[model samples]
Target: MTFSIVARSGQALGIAVASKFLAVGAVVPAAEAGAGAVATQAAANLRYLPQGLALLRTGVPPADVVAGLVAADRERAHRQVGIVGPEGPGATYTGEECLDWAGGRAGDGYAIQGNILTGPEVVEAMESAWLSSPQEELDRRLLAVLAAGDAAGGDRRGRQSAALYVVSPGAGYGGGSDVACDLRVDDHPDPVGELRRLRDVHELLFGTPDPGTLLDLSGELKEEVQSLVAERGYASLDMWVGVENLENRLVSGKIDPVVLARLRDAAPDGK
Candidate 1:
Protein backbone atom coordinates (compact mmCIF):
# COMPACT_ATOMS: atom_id res chain seq x y z
CA MET A 1 0.00 0.00 0.00
CA THR A 2 2.10 2.88 -1.25
CA PHE A 3 2.17 6.00 -3.40
CA SER A 4 5.25 7.56 -4.90
CA ILE A 5 6.73 10.01 -7.41
CA VAL A 6 10.01 9.64 -9.24
CA ALA A 7 11.24 12.76 -11.00
CA ARG A 8 14.14 14.45 -12.75
CA SER A 9 14.67 18.16 -13.39
CA GLY A 10 17.92 19.63 -14.58
CA GLN A 11 20.69 17.75 -12.77
CA ALA A 12 18.61 16.64 -9.79
CA LEU A 13 16.66 13.40 -9.34
CA GLY A 14 14.66 12.12 -6.40
CA ILE A 15 11.71 10.18 -5.00
CA ALA A 16 9.00 10.86 -2.45
CA VAL A 17 6.84 8.10 -0.98
CA ALA A 18 4.22 7.29 1.65
CA SER A 19 2.66 4.00 2.67
CA LYS A 20 0.83 1.84 5.15
CA PHE A 21 4.01 -0.14 5.60
CA LEU A 22 6.90 0.52 7.96
CA ALA A 23 9.98 2.34 6.65
CA VAL A 24 8.67 2.57 3.13
CA GLY A 25 11.65 4.78 2.30
CA ALA A 26 14.10 1.97 2.94
CA VAL A 27 12.04 -0.44 0.89
CA VAL A 28 10.78 1.59 -2.07
CA PRO A 29 13.00 4.55 -2.90
CA ALA A 30 16.33 4.80 -4.69
CA ALA A 31 18.08 7.59 -6.63
CA GLU A 32 21.38 8.79 -8.02
CA ALA A 33 22.14 12.41 -8.80
CA GLY A 34 22.72 13.05 -12.52
CA ALA A 35 21.60 9.49 -13.28
CA GLY A 36 17.96 8.89 -12.35
CA ALA A 37 15.53 7.76 -9.64
CA VAL A 38 13.27 4.74 -9.10
CA ALA A 39 10.47 3.71 -6.76
CA THR A 40 9.65 0.01 -6.53
CA GLN A 41 6.73 -1.16 -4.42
CA ALA A 42 3.62 -3.35 -4.30
CA ALA A 43 5.57 -6.57 -4.31
CA ALA A 44 8.75 -4.59 -4.76
CA ASN A 45 11.77 -6.18 -6.36
CA LEU A 46 14.64 -4.57 -4.49
CA ARG A 47 16.91 -5.32 -7.40
CA TYR A 48 15.19 -2.66 -9.48
CA LEU A 49 16.86 0.00 -7.38
CA PRO A 50 20.46 -0.85 -8.23
CA GLN A 51 19.70 -2.32 -11.63
CA GLY A 52 17.54 0.57 -12.70
CA LEU A 53 20.13 3.06 -11.54
CA ALA A 54 22.81 1.09 -13.32
CA LEU A 55 20.75 1.18 -16.48
CA LEU A 56 20.23 4.91 -16.18
CA ARG A 57 23.94 5.40 -15.63
CA THR A 58 24.55 3.57 -18.87
CA GLY A 59 22.38 6.16 -20.69
CA VAL A 60 19.41 3.82 -21.00
CA PRO A 61 16.11 5.62 -21.42
CA PRO A 62 13.81 5.46 -18.38
CA ALA A 63 11.07 3.68 -20.37
CA ASP A 64 13.58 1.04 -21.43
CA VAL A 65 14.76 0.60 -17.87
CA VAL A 66 11.20 -0.04 -16.75
CA ALA A 67 10.73 -2.54 -19.56
CA GLY A 68 13.97 -4.35 -18.72
CA LEU A 69 13.22 -4.48 -15.01
CA VAL A 70 9.73 -5.86 -15.45
CA ALA A 71 10.99 -8.33 -18.00
CA ALA A 72 13.67 -9.66 -15.67
CA ASP A 73 11.29 -10.25 -12.77
CA ARG A 74 9.37 -13.54 -12.57
CA GLU A 75 6.70 -11.90 -10.41
CA ARG A 76 6.48 -8.79 -12.56
CA ALA A 77 2.73 -9.12 -12.61
CA HIS A 78 2.58 -8.08 -8.99
CA ARG A 79 5.19 -5.33 -9.02
CA GLN A 80 4.68 -1.58 -9.38
CA VAL A 81 7.47 0.81 -10.34
CA GLY A 82 8.21 4.38 -11.48
CA ILE A 83 11.35 5.78 -13.04
CA VAL A 84 12.72 9.10 -14.37
CA GLY A 85 16.04 10.36 -15.62
CA PRO A 86 17.75 13.56 -16.76
CA GLU A 87 17.08 12.75 -20.39
CA GLY A 88 14.83 10.80 -22.74
CA PRO A 89 11.59 10.12 -20.85
CA GLY A 90 9.93 8.86 -17.66
CA ALA A 91 7.89 5.67 -17.16
CA THR A 92 5.73 3.85 -14.63
CA TYR A 93 4.32 0.32 -14.36
CA THR A 94 1.46 -1.18 -12.34
CA GLY A 95 1.13 -4.90 -12.62
CA GLU A 96 -2.24 -6.38 -13.55
CA GLU A 97 -2.26 -8.16 -10.19
CA CYS A 98 -1.85 -4.95 -8.20
CA LEU A 99 -4.70 -4.07 -5.84
CA ASP A 100 -7.96 -2.62 -7.12
CA TRP A 101 -7.05 1.07 -6.93
CA ALA A 102 -3.71 0.56 -8.64
CA GLY A 103 -2.43 2.74 -11.52
CA GLY A 104 0.06 5.43 -12.49
CA ARG A 105 0.67 8.44 -14.74
CA ALA A 106 3.75 9.73 -16.52
CA GLY A 107 4.56 13.31 -17.46
CA ASP A 108 7.35 15.45 -18.88
CA GLY A 109 9.75 14.76 -16.04
CA TYR A 110 7.86 12.69 -13.51
CA ALA A 111 6.09 9.40 -12.92
CA ILE A 112 3.39 9.10 -10.26
CA GLN A 113 2.04 5.76 -9.07
CA GLY A 114 0.15 4.03 -6.31
CA ASN A 115 -1.58 0.84 -5.23
CA ILE A 116 -4.27 0.25 -2.61
CA LEU A 117 -4.92 3.94 -2.80
CA THR A 118 -8.15 5.78 -2.15
CA GLY A 119 -8.65 6.20 -5.89
CA PRO A 120 -7.14 7.69 -9.05
CA GLU A 121 -7.36 11.07 -7.40
CA VAL A 122 -4.40 10.17 -5.22
CA VAL A 123 -1.99 10.01 -8.14
CA GLU A 124 -3.73 12.86 -9.89
CA ALA A 125 -3.36 15.13 -6.90
CA MET A 126 0.29 14.19 -6.63
CA GLU A 127 0.84 15.03 -10.30
CA SER A 128 -0.92 18.34 -9.91
CA ALA A 129 1.13 19.34 -6.92
CA TRP A 130 4.39 18.26 -8.50
CA LEU A 131 3.63 20.36 -11.54
CA SER A 132 2.35 23.37 -9.62
CA SER A 133 4.70 23.51 -6.65
CA PRO A 134 6.61 26.81 -6.76
CA GLN A 135 9.68 25.37 -5.14
CA GLU A 136 12.69 25.08 -7.46
CA GLU A 137 14.35 22.25 -5.57
CA LEU A 138 13.47 18.71 -6.53
CA ASP A 139 13.19 17.63 -2.89
CA ARG A 140 10.63 20.31 -2.11
CA ARG A 141 8.66 19.45 -5.22
CA LEU A 142 8.65 15.81 -4.18
CA LEU A 143 7.51 16.65 -0.67
CA ALA A 144 4.76 18.89 -1.95
CA VAL A 145 3.41 16.10 -4.13
CA LEU A 146 3.53 13.64 -1.26
CA ALA A 147 1.62 16.08 0.91
CA ALA A 148 -0.89 16.57 -1.84
CA GLY A 149 -1.32 12.81 -2.21
CA ASP A 150 -1.74 12.42 1.53
CA ALA A 151 -4.42 15.10 1.45
CA ALA A 152 -6.10 13.36 -1.49
CA GLY A 153 -6.65 10.21 0.54
CA GLY A 154 -3.31 8.46 0.50
CA ASP A 155 -3.04 4.73 1.07
CA ARG A 156 -6.54 3.36 1.57
CA ARG A 157 -4.97 1.12 4.16
CA GLY A 158 -3.74 4.17 6.16
CA ARG A 159 -0.43 5.89 6.68
CA GLN A 160 2.48 4.62 8.74
CA SER A 161 5.66 5.95 7.12
CA ALA A 162 6.89 8.47 4.57
CA ALA A 163 10.16 9.55 3.02
CA LEU A 164 11.90 12.04 0.68
CA TYR A 165 15.09 10.98 -1.05
CA VAL A 166 17.18 13.22 -3.34
CA VAL A 167 20.59 13.18 -4.92
CA SER A 168 22.75 15.90 -6.50
CA PRO A 169 26.43 15.83 -7.31
CA GLY A 170 28.45 17.46 -4.47
CA ALA A 171 25.31 18.51 -2.64
CA GLY A 172 25.75 16.50 0.54
CA TYR A 173 27.09 17.92 3.76
CA GLY A 174 30.45 19.64 3.14
CA GLY A 175 30.18 18.59 -0.49
CA GLY A 176 31.32 15.12 0.53
CA SER A 177 28.65 13.15 -1.34
CA ASP A 178 25.58 13.28 -3.58
CA VAL A 179 22.88 12.55 -0.98
CA ALA A 180 21.33 15.99 -1.13
CA CYS A 181 18.43 14.99 1.10
CA ASP A 182 17.17 11.79 2.76
CA LEU A 183 14.43 12.27 5.34
CA ARG A 184 12.10 9.56 6.62
CA VAL A 185 9.29 9.16 9.09
CA ASP A 186 9.48 5.48 9.95
CA ASP A 187 6.28 5.40 12.06
CA HIS A 188 3.97 8.26 12.78
CA PRO A 189 0.28 9.03 12.96
CA ASP A 190 0.88 11.88 10.51
CA PRO A 191 4.04 10.88 8.75
CA VAL A 192 3.52 13.32 5.89
CA GLY A 193 3.26 16.23 8.30
CA GLU A 194 6.33 15.04 10.16
CA LEU A 195 8.15 14.65 6.89
CA ARG A 196 7.23 18.22 5.95
CA ARG A 197 8.51 19.52 9.24
CA LEU A 198 11.77 17.67 8.74
CA ARG A 199 12.07 19.08 5.23
CA ASP A 200 11.82 22.62 6.59
CA VAL A 201 14.48 21.92 9.17
CA HIS A 202 16.61 20.34 6.51
CA GLU A 203 16.37 23.48 4.42
CA LEU A 204 17.26 25.67 7.34
CA LEU A 205 20.34 23.61 8.07
CA PHE A 206 21.45 22.70 4.59
CA GLY A 207 19.92 25.07 2.05
CA THR A 208 22.07 27.81 0.69
CA PRO A 209 20.61 31.25 1.26
CA ASP A 210 20.17 33.36 -1.82
CA PRO A 211 22.73 36.11 -2.02
CA GLY A 212 20.10 38.56 -3.11
CA THR A 213 17.95 37.62 -0.13
CA LEU A 214 20.72 37.60 2.45
CA LEU A 215 20.61 40.07 5.29
CA ASP A 216 23.71 42.09 6.09
CA LEU A 217 25.31 41.38 9.47
CA SER A 218 26.59 44.64 10.92
CA GLY A 219 26.26 47.15 13.78
CA GLU A 220 23.87 46.03 16.58
CA LEU A 221 22.78 42.98 14.58
CA LYS A 222 26.38 41.86 14.22
CA GLU A 223 27.00 42.15 17.96
CA GLU A 224 23.82 40.22 18.69
CA VAL A 225 24.90 37.52 16.31
CA GLN A 226 28.31 37.22 17.95
CA SER A 227 26.78 37.13 21.42
CA LEU A 228 24.49 34.29 20.43
CA VAL A 229 27.34 32.38 18.87
CA ALA A 230 29.56 32.81 21.97
CA GLU A 231 26.75 31.69 24.22
CA ARG A 232 26.71 28.42 22.32
CA GLY A 233 30.40 27.91 23.23
CA TYR A 234 31.58 28.79 19.75
CA ALA A 235 34.55 31.13 19.48
CA SER A 236 33.21 32.90 16.39
CA LEU A 237 30.22 33.20 14.09
CA ASP A 238 31.95 31.09 11.44
CA MET A 239 32.60 28.39 14.03
CA TRP A 240 28.95 28.38 15.03
CA VAL A 241 27.81 28.15 11.43
CA GLY A 242 30.19 25.29 10.75
CA VAL A 243 29.24 23.48 13.95
CA GLU A 244 25.56 23.82 13.18
CA ASN A 245 26.09 22.66 9.59
CA LEU A 246 24.76 25.97 8.28
CA GLU A 247 27.42 26.41 5.68
CA ASN A 248 24.82 26.44 2.94
CA ARG A 249 22.69 29.06 4.68
CA LEU A 250 25.63 31.13 5.82
CA VAL A 251 27.70 31.30 2.67
CA SER A 252 29.26 34.73 3.22
CA GLY A 253 31.38 35.50 6.26
CA LYS A 254 28.63 37.95 7.09
CA ILE A 255 25.60 36.43 8.81
CA ASP A 256 22.21 36.07 7.17
CA PRO A 257 19.54 38.13 8.91
CA VAL A 258 17.22 35.14 9.03
CA VAL A 259 19.98 33.06 10.55
CA LEU A 260 20.75 35.77 13.08
CA ALA A 261 17.11 35.98 14.06
CA ARG A 262 16.86 32.19 14.51
CA LEU A 263 19.99 32.09 16.61
CA ARG A 264 18.65 34.81 18.86
CA ASP A 265 15.31 33.10 19.22
CA ALA A 266 16.96 29.77 19.92
CA ALA A 267 19.32 31.11 22.59
CA PRO A 268 18.88 28.80 25.60
CA ASP A 269 19.06 31.68 28.06
CA GLY A 270 17.00 33.97 25.80
CA LYS A 271 19.83 36.44 25.55
Candidate 2:
Protein backbone atom coordinates (compact mmCIF):
# COMPACT_ATOMS: atom_id res chain seq x y z
CA MET A 1 0.00 0.00 0.00
CA THR A 2 3.02 2.26 0.32
CA PHE A 3 6.50 2.99 -0.99
CA SER A 4 8.98 4.72 1.28
CA ILE A 5 12.65 5.49 1.83
CA VAL A 6 14.39 5.85 5.18
CA ALA A 7 17.71 7.63 4.81
CA ARG A 8 20.46 9.76 6.31
CA SER A 9 22.25 12.76 4.84
CA GLY A 10 25.11 14.00 7.00
CA GLN A 11 23.60 14.90 10.37
CA ALA A 12 20.00 14.81 9.10
CA LEU A 13 17.69 11.83 8.57
CA GLY A 14 14.29 11.58 6.82
CA ILE A 15 11.50 9.49 5.31
CA ALA A 16 9.60 10.16 2.06
CA VAL A 17 6.56 8.10 1.19
CA ALA A 18 3.53 7.91 -1.13
CA SER A 19 0.68 5.48 -0.82
CA LYS A 20 -2.84 4.41 -1.66
CA PHE A 21 -3.38 4.76 2.07
CA LEU A 22 -4.57 8.04 3.55
CA ALA A 23 -2.11 9.91 5.78
CA VAL A 24 0.70 7.44 5.13
CA GLY A 25 3.01 9.99 6.84
CA ALA A 26 1.28 9.52 10.18
CA VAL A 27 1.75 5.74 10.15
CA VAL A 28 4.79 4.72 8.11
CA PRO A 29 7.66 7.21 8.60
CA ALA A 30 9.44 7.88 11.92
CA ALA A 31 12.84 9.27 12.82
CA GLU A 32 14.95 11.07 15.43
CA ALA A 33 17.91 13.37 15.14
CA GLY A 34 21.30 11.67 15.54
CA ALA A 35 19.49 8.38 16.08
CA GLY A 36 17.86 6.85 12.97
CA ALA A 37 14.77 6.59 10.78
CA VAL A 38 12.37 3.77 9.91
CA ALA A 39 9.64 2.93 7.38
CA THR A 40 7.05 0.49 8.67
CA GLN A 41 4.39 -0.64 6.21
CA ALA A 42 2.53 -3.64 4.74
CA ALA A 43 0.11 -3.89 7.61
CA ALA A 44 2.32 -1.44 9.40
CA ASN A 45 2.89 -2.01 13.09
CA LEU A 46 3.05 1.51 14.52
CA ARG A 47 4.87 0.13 17.54
CA TYR A 48 7.92 -0.47 15.38
CA LEU A 49 8.32 3.31 15.07
CA PRO A 50 9.30 4.00 18.69
CA GLN A 51 10.76 0.53 19.23
CA GLY A 52 13.06 0.66 16.23
CA LEU A 53 14.38 4.09 17.15
CA ALA A 54 14.88 2.96 20.74
CA LEU A 55 16.93 0.02 19.55
CA LEU A 56 19.00 2.17 17.25
CA ARG A 57 19.52 4.65 20.07
CA THR A 58 20.80 1.79 22.24
CA GLY A 59 23.49 1.10 19.63
CA VAL A 60 21.70 -1.82 18.02
CA PRO A 61 22.68 -2.25 14.39
CA PRO A 62 19.93 -1.66 11.80
CA ALA A 63 19.93 -5.32 10.68
CA ASP A 64 19.54 -6.52 14.27
CA VAL A 65 16.85 -3.93 14.87
CA VAL A 66 14.86 -5.35 11.97
CA ALA A 67 15.44 -8.85 13.30
CA GLY A 68 14.40 -8.05 16.87
CA LEU A 69 11.26 -6.14 15.86
CA VAL A 70 9.90 -8.90 13.63
CA ALA A 71 10.90 -11.58 16.10
CA ALA A 72 8.89 -9.98 18.87
CA ASP A 73 5.78 -9.45 16.78
CA ARG A 74 3.28 -12.33 16.62
CA GLU A 75 2.22 -11.00 13.20
CA ARG A 76 5.77 -10.82 11.83
CA ALA A 77 4.82 -12.54 8.60
CA HIS A 78 2.40 -9.71 7.77
CA ARG A 79 4.83 -6.84 8.43
CA GLN A 80 7.43 -5.06 6.35
CA VAL A 81 10.01 -2.65 7.84
CA GLY A 82 13.17 -0.74 6.94
CA ILE A 83 15.68 0.83 9.31
CA VAL A 84 18.70 3.11 9.02
CA GLY A 85 20.50 3.40 12.32
CA PRO A 86 22.81 5.92 14.03
CA GLU A 87 25.61 4.61 11.89
CA GLY A 88 26.65 2.18 9.15
CA PRO A 89 24.47 0.91 6.28
CA GLY A 90 20.68 0.50 6.43
CA ALA A 91 18.40 -2.60 6.48
CA THR A 92 15.02 -3.73 5.08
CA TYR A 93 12.53 -6.57 5.64
CA THR A 94 9.46 -7.94 3.86
CA GLY A 95 7.03 -10.37 5.38
CA GLU A 96 6.12 -13.54 3.54
CA GLU A 97 2.44 -12.72 3.84
CA CYS A 98 2.66 -9.19 2.49
CA LEU A 99 0.83 -8.35 -0.73
CA ASP A 100 1.89 -9.96 -4.01
CA TRP A 101 4.13 -7.08 -5.18
CA ALA A 102 5.96 -6.29 -1.96
CA GLY A 103 9.73 -6.17 -1.30
CA GLY A 104 12.55 -3.85 -0.12
CA ARG A 105 16.25 -3.03 -0.42
CA ALA A 106 18.87 -1.59 1.96
CA GLY A 107 22.26 -0.08 1.24
CA ASP A 108 24.71 2.59 2.34
CA GLY A 109 22.89 5.19 4.44
CA TYR A 110 19.43 4.35 3.07
CA ALA A 111 16.68 1.77 2.56
CA ILE A 112 13.92 1.70 -0.10
CA GLN A 113 10.77 -0.41 0.14
CA GLY A 114 7.16 -0.80 -0.99
CA ASN A 115 4.11 -3.05 -1.09
CA ILE A 116 1.43 -3.61 -3.76
CA LEU A 117 3.57 -1.71 -6.22
CA THR A 118 3.59 -2.03 -10.02
CA GLY A 119 6.70 -4.26 -9.90
CA PRO A 120 10.30 -4.46 -8.74
CA GLU A 121 11.04 -1.57 -11.03
CA VAL A 122 9.36 0.82 -8.61
CA VAL A 123 11.95 0.18 -5.94
CA GLU A 124 14.73 -0.10 -8.51
CA ALA A 125 13.95 3.38 -9.80
CA MET A 126 13.94 4.73 -6.24
CA GLU A 127 17.32 3.18 -5.51
CA SER A 128 18.75 4.64 -8.66
CA ALA A 129 17.56 8.17 -7.81
CA TRP A 130 18.86 7.94 -4.26
CA LEU A 131 22.28 6.77 -5.40
CA SER A 132 22.53 9.14 -8.33
CA SER A 133 22.20 12.24 -6.15
CA PRO A 134 24.56 11.70 -3.23
CA GLN A 135 25.15 15.43 -2.77
CA GLU A 136 21.58 16.77 -2.34
CA GLU A 137 20.29 17.97 1.02
CA LEU A 138 18.42 15.33 3.03
CA ASP A 139 14.88 16.56 2.35
CA ARG A 140 15.48 17.01 -1.38
CA ARG A 141 17.23 13.67 -1.68
CA LEU A 142 14.42 11.79 0.00
CA LEU A 143 11.82 13.58 -2.13
CA ALA A 144 13.74 12.68 -5.27
CA VAL A 145 13.73 9.02 -4.26
CA LEU A 146 10.01 8.99 -3.56
CA ALA A 147 9.35 10.78 -6.84
CA ALA A 148 11.26 8.11 -8.73
CA GLY A 149 9.24 5.31 -7.13
CA ASP A 150 6.09 7.32 -7.91
CA ALA A 151 7.04 7.74 -11.57
CA ALA A 152 7.67 4.00 -11.91
CA GLY A 153 4.15 3.22 -10.57
CA GLY A 154 3.89 3.35 -6.81
CA ASP A 155 1.00 1.61 -5.02
CA ARG A 156 -0.73 -0.34 -7.78
CA ARG A 157 -3.96 0.54 -6.08
CA GLY A 158 -3.24 4.25 -6.91
CA ARG A 159 -2.12 7.40 -5.11
CA GLN A 160 -4.01 9.32 -2.47
CA SER A 161 -1.37 10.54 -0.03
CA ALA A 162 2.32 11.47 0.13
CA ALA A 163 4.69 12.95 2.71
CA LEU A 164 8.23 14.21 3.23
CA TYR A 165 9.69 14.36 6.74
CA VAL A 166 13.24 15.12 7.85
CA VAL A 167 15.01 15.88 11.10
CA SER A 168 18.37 17.32 12.09
CA PRO A 169 19.64 18.72 15.37
CA GLY A 170 18.64 22.39 15.69
CA ALA A 171 17.18 22.42 12.19
CA GLY A 172 13.56 23.10 13.01
CA TYR A 173 11.80 26.43 12.90
CA GLY A 174 13.94 28.92 14.85
CA GLY A 175 16.01 25.87 15.91
CA GLY A 176 13.21 24.77 18.21
CA SER A 177 12.80 21.09 17.22
CA ASP A 178 14.33 18.20 15.32
CA VAL A 179 11.86 18.44 12.45
CA ALA A 180 13.49 20.24 9.57
CA CYS A 181 10.99 19.61 6.79
CA ASP A 182 7.47 18.20 7.10
CA LEU A 183 5.03 18.31 4.20
CA ARG A 184 2.06 16.08 3.44
CA VAL A 185 -0.46 15.59 0.67
CA ASP A 186 -2.98 13.48 2.52
CA ASP A 187 -5.40 13.25 -0.43
CA HIS A 188 -4.60 14.13 -4.00
CA PRO A 189 -4.95 12.79 -7.51
CA ASP A 190 -1.26 13.54 -8.08
CA PRO A 191 0.06 13.30 -4.59
CA VAL A 192 3.69 12.97 -5.68
CA GLY A 193 3.46 16.05 -7.85
CA GLU A 194 1.62 17.86 -5.11
CA LEU A 195 4.36 16.91 -2.69
CA ARG A 196 6.94 18.48 -4.99
CA ARG A 197 4.94 21.70 -5.10
CA LEU A 198 4.51 21.72 -1.33
CA ARG A 199 8.24 21.12 -0.89
CA ASP A 200 8.98 24.18 -3.04
CA VAL A 201 6.59 26.26 -0.94
CA HIS A 202 8.14 24.89 2.24
CA GLU A 203 11.53 26.15 1.13
CA LEU A 204 10.12 29.47 0.11
CA LEU A 205 8.48 29.90 3.47
CA PHE A 206 10.97 28.30 5.83
CA GLY A 207 14.31 28.08 4.09
CA THR A 208 17.03 30.54 5.00
CA PRO A 209 17.92 33.24 2.58
CA ASP A 210 21.00 32.67 0.44
CA PRO A 211 23.34 35.65 0.69
CA GLY A 212 24.55 35.00 -2.82
CA THR A 213 21.04 35.50 -4.18
CA LEU A 214 20.08 38.58 -2.19
CA LEU A 215 18.62 41.34 -4.36
CA ASP A 216 19.40 45.02 -3.87
CA LEU A 217 16.67 46.76 -1.85
CA SER A 218 16.88 49.95 -3.90
CA GLY A 219 15.19 51.69 -6.84
CA GLU A 220 12.71 49.59 -8.86
CA LEU A 221 13.20 46.49 -6.69
CA LYS A 222 12.24 48.39 -3.53
CA GLU A 223 9.29 50.02 -5.30
CA GLU A 224 8.08 46.63 -6.53
CA VAL A 225 8.29 45.18 -3.07
CA GLN A 226 6.20 47.98 -1.62
CA SER A 227 3.60 47.66 -4.37
CA LEU A 228 3.18 43.90 -3.98
CA VAL A 229 2.50 44.23 -0.26
CA ALA A 230 0.04 47.07 -0.90
CA GLU A 231 -1.97 44.89 -3.25
CA ARG A 232 -2.94 42.86 -0.18
CA GLY A 233 -3.82 46.03 1.82
CA TYR A 234 -0.57 46.05 3.76
CA ALA A 235 1.26 49.39 3.86
CA SER A 236 4.76 47.92 4.35
CA LEU A 237 6.58 44.93 2.95
CA ASP A 238 7.56 43.85 6.48
CA MET A 239 3.89 43.77 7.50
CA TRP A 240 2.93 41.40 4.72
CA VAL A 241 5.99 39.28 5.34
CA GLY A 242 5.20 39.12 9.04
CA VAL A 243 1.55 38.35 8.34
CA GLU A 244 2.64 35.54 6.04
CA ASN A 245 5.07 34.23 8.70
CA LEU A 246 8.02 34.81 6.43
CA GLU A 247 10.00 37.09 8.73
CA ASN A 248 12.80 34.57 8.94
CA ARG A 249 13.39 34.68 5.22
CA LEU A 250 13.34 38.50 5.31
CA VAL A 251 16.86 38.85 6.64
CA SER A 252 18.67 42.07 7.42
CA GLY A 253 15.88 44.16 5.90
CA LYS A 254 16.19 42.26 2.63
CA ILE A 255 13.49 40.03 1.15
CA ASP A 256 14.36 36.53 -0.03
CA PRO A 257 14.59 36.21 -3.79
CA VAL A 258 12.02 33.42 -3.77
CA VAL A 259 9.59 35.54 -1.77
CA LEU A 260 9.87 38.26 -4.37
CA ALA A 261 9.17 35.72 -7.08
CA ARG A 262 6.17 34.49 -5.11
CA LEU A 263 4.84 38.03 -4.77
CA ARG A 264 5.11 38.55 -8.49
CA ASP A 265 3.36 35.28 -9.19
CA ALA A 266 0.56 36.16 -6.79
CA ALA A 267 0.01 39.65 -8.24
CA PRO A 268 -3.16 40.25 -10.27
CA ASP A 269 -2.87 40.20 -14.08
CA GLY A 270 0.65 38.78 -13.74
CA LYS A 271 2.09 42.23 -13.11
Top candidate on lDDT is: 2
Q: Give a tens-digit lDDT track for model 1, residues 1-271.
A: 9999999878888999999999999999999888899999999999999999999999999999999999989899999999998876689999999996999999888999999999999999998898886466788788889999999999999989999999889989879999999999999999999999999999888777777777667788778777777787778777776666776776555667667767777665333
Shift of residue 81 alpha carbon in model 1, Å: 0.6
Off by over 4 Å in 1: 230-234, 251-253, 269-271
Q: How many steric clashes between backbone atoms does each model show?
A: 0, 0
TM-score against native, each model = 0.93, 0.93
